[model samples]
Target: MSIWICRACGAHSESRSGPPPKCSICDDERQFVPEGGQEWIARETLASTHSNDWTELEPNLISIGVSPAIGIGQRALLVLSSHGNVLWDCVPVLDRKTRDRILELGGIKAICLSHPHFYTGMVEWSEALGGVPILLPQADLVYVTRTSEHIRPWLGDRYEVLPGITLHRLGGHFEGSCVLEWEAGAEQNGALLVGDTIQVVPAKGWVSFMYSFPNLIPLPAREVRRIASRVADIRFDRIYGAWKEKVISSKARESVARSAERYIRRLES
Candidate 1:
């Protein structure tokens, strides 16, 4: 038996003789199965062809992504702090080189995911790093496909995973969709490691909230407002999106407010 990973969404499944009949995560309304149909890959297969690529986005933040674009093509952000390193999101492929590099820069102390879409190979990652605790929102616990002892389900609107790094649930994409507020990031101006909960649009200094990004489904106006309101008081100067180069470097707090107002206005119109 081998741990199978969904090719479409990168979610891991239990050890099995072969690929599961279907992928629940991709079959859901928010995600979709490709026209080519559902597919699965073994952990060893992924390691053979793909490799982890690391880039330093800032002094204490590192962007880790997979080459050849495994799964949903999302990159994980490694936030370094005096307390410990926290992996904001996760990728499907983890190889020996990547594991060694992470160890050199101080092994991960905790792993917190923004949502289920990025839950790819999280258990494997935690095991590789000597059983780091995986902090997931309690509301989204149902989405976890592969169970592990390292998984820690947290409740409520906010959780301080570390001393200065906090996870704030905004609830746009999923019930437990959250963002990491690095209080000491962006040169003390603060930074937000936001996944798809609040999407950074192509236009600079702008973001959008959605229920389904790939399906083009818009979130309710009230829900969008609520998400914005949740982070209204959090002072953050930078906003990092799920993909590479999608960032609001400065005035990110204002960007969220402005974007929310714009989204609401368009809805009312």
Candidate 2:
């Protein structure tokens, strides 16, 4: 058996003979199958050609992404903490060099996900790093195609990964969509790792909420308000989105609030 990855979404599927007929994640309403139809790539092939690139987002936070951009092109954050390091999101490709560098940085204590869209190769990631636990939202468990012993399902609106690292559920993009609030980040002002749950839009100092990004579908006004209200009390100076360079540098809380207001107004209009 081999792990087949969807070319469009970077979601992993286990197949005994060949790649699955179609990627369920891509067939879903939120995502789309490419014009060429669903395509699959073997993990070994991906590892041979692609490699992960690293960038220091802040003092203790590092961003890792696959160079040449495969499978949604999302970057994962390696959050270094005294308690242990936490991988905030996951990418499709994980090679020897990437694993070695992470091992040098104390390995991963836990693998946390924002939603199912970025659940690519999570089981692989956990197994590679000492079988660390993969924390996923229970509500979105249906979207998980691949399974492993290390996968842990979490419920409710709030979860504490560590003493100061918290996961807050703000259900807009997905029923169990969550964000990581690192209290020690942003030079102690705090940082929120939101994987398109509240997207940092192209507009400067602003963010947006959506039910479907590629399909251009919008979330309900109430849902947007609920998402805004969920993070209203959290203290965060910086907000990191899934893609590289997608961030609200500062005043992120205020930006989210006003952005929510704007989204609501436009929907009502």
Q: What lDDT tens digits, residue by residue, belong to model 2 across residues 31-51? A: 999999989999888888899
lDDT of 1 by residue, 121-225 (tens): 899999999999999999999999889999999889999989989999988899999999999999999999999888999998999998999999999899988
Query: How do all models score by TM-score?
Result: 0.98, 0.99
Q: Give the TM-score of candidate 2.
A: 0.99
As for model 2, its CA RMSD to the true structure in angstroms is 0.7
TM-score of 1: 0.98
For model 2, the superposed segments whose C-alpha errors exceed 4 Å read none
* Lowest summed lDDT window (length 10), candidate 1: 14-23
Which regions of candidate 1 are displaced past 4 Å? Answer: none
